[model samples]
Target: MGLGSYLIYIALLMIVPLWAQSKVKNTYKKYAKKATSSFMTGAQVARQILDDNGLYHVKIEETRGMLSDHYDPRKKVVRLSRDNYHGHSMAASAIAAHEVGHAIQDEQAYAFLRFRHSLFPIASLGDKMSIFLIIAGFILGASGLIMAGIVFMGFAVLFQLVTLPVEFDASNRAMAQLVSSGVIRNNEERDTKKVLNAAALTYVAAAMVAVAELIRFVLMFVASDD
Candidate 1:
């Protein structure tokens, strides 16, 4: 790709995530206002699901920040944002269930989630070191260093790719749990799906950006060789 094309690609990398973030936020905001028919809080829903799945040891804690919910596999804890933890809304129920889905995955040793976890250390190191190594390689005119950097970048890209399946499976589990547990009524399932799907888009956008950047880096490296 030419310089102009590269510029456009970079712009897209920036735009796609922003757009996905906006979509999730807007969708969450819309559904957050609409209470579930069950009138159950996010924490309550999560607790019920965890207990039903025999995850009594896994704990749910209230966390600060907007949409900061996550399951810490190391700690065996599901942390929910304050809004979701306390709010009795469709968004809350959906998000809470999604995080608990991860906990269930942990208990079951879900393959993709296990693979992703195993890759996390290398991916974290790659994320931290790749840019600096690549820049240093260019400065020193060292193709070896550049290739090493690209390899590290490749790991990060793989991590993102693996993450896609892990997230989608979690969302699928979340919806099933929601239905089975009666946390969300049949009529409310559609909007709950909207919330989970919007959240899933953010992961899709992240993986796309990572793959695109890796391709751009490889192209730059090959051009330098020429």
Candidate 2:
């Protein structure tokens, strides 16, 4: 609860992001080189899945990040990152299919993804509010402000929890569709699984960092009060 304890927590917090980033980058690179099945570009694969599911309105567009692909429920579009957008590898097919899984979720009104997307605005606001509330609480020496900060951070934690099911479902759908539709052969299943699993770990890593930071903030308030 003292300065040394807080410093250690902060240092640990810093490590997850770097480690997660490195793992994702390495996984993508490793699969990119080893991929042998080259049936379609990532974009083509995504579009194929979308059309196959009759989601004609859900457009697949390029976004500007390495492995930053995602589905925008609001825009009803799939955004593919640079590597998978044009890359023709098992990794690309998997990435593209994963985003499409989200689109499928939208069509079927999957509970978890819907909940997560619905919480986006509240979670975004709470994330900023938590910081301000915590700092103001510390400066004013008020337990009430710290309590409010905790509440605000609670939404951030909840968002992370809500994301797990959504992410896992997408990966499941991606792998299933790939296997069933003959997009990825049985021999290539492991490659896709490797990419998706590595990507999922990054989400888990982010959630852990948020939870750790929240604990550190709570410790600060408890220490100050003592």
Candidate 3:
């Protein structure tokens, strides 16, 4: 049963992300061609929302990448991909607003976002080291190293867990801002939400995969003991 469960989790780890990415890509592709009623570029929407939220210091910068939009809390800047920064489509508006939502969270000192930020350094290190440590532990039959690896992996899993609420809240803030700032109309709200929801699923999928990996590691540790 344990082996079967582990294999199932392994399958999920492989399948979930691919499914999530497909949803995001499909949803984005569908909406990217659908122009917003306001016809405002993503930069314009981001600028308007930021200014309205009294985040005047938050700068909007264009970046090169697909789906690389993010808010740099340290730099106090909202970076949008070239497509989002210049495009005037539902996908552009939704993505821009979602990133600006992170800016708003930063300004408000959102608890989850702050917590996630705090966890980033350790989580990053753990993410990089945990797999190697686990593999080495298994190879050398060192239970202590296996336990240490599990602890490190735990931090990464915790980070992923905390990231969920932060992402969901950002999307919520994005929708509210989009509506309140008149960036998207009532008729367009559904489609905008579809875009954001699809994006959120990617995060959810990632968190699930992280959790499953942690469980798999724990199971491995137990099996090693026997």
- The most accurate candidate by TM-score is 1
TM per candidate comes to: 0.98, 0.92, 0.97
Question: Model-by-model lDDT, in order?
Answer: 0.95, 0.86, 0.93
Question: Model 3 TM-score?
Answer: 0.97
How does residue 172 of candidate 3 score in lDDT? 97
Better of 2 and 3 by lDDT: 3
Colliding pairs, model 2: none
Give the Å shift of residue 195 in candidate 3.
Answer: 0.3
Candidate 2: lDDT over CA atoms?
A: 0.86
Best by lDDT: 1
Candidate 2 lDDT over residue span 1-226, tens digit each: 6789778777668887788878888988888766536477889888888888899999889999777788998899999998788888888888899999999999999999779978888888889899899889888987899889988898988899889889999999999988876788878998889999988888888888888888878777777878
Q: Write the per-residue lDDT of candidate 1 for residues 1-226, one digit (tens) a residue.
A: 9889888788769999999999999999999999999999999999999999999999999999999999999999999999999999999999999999999999999999999999999999998899889989999999988999999988998999999999999999999999999998889999999999999999999998998888888998999999
For model 3, name the residue pairs that clash: none
lDDT of 3 at 145: 85
Q: Which TM-score value belongs to model 2? A: 0.92
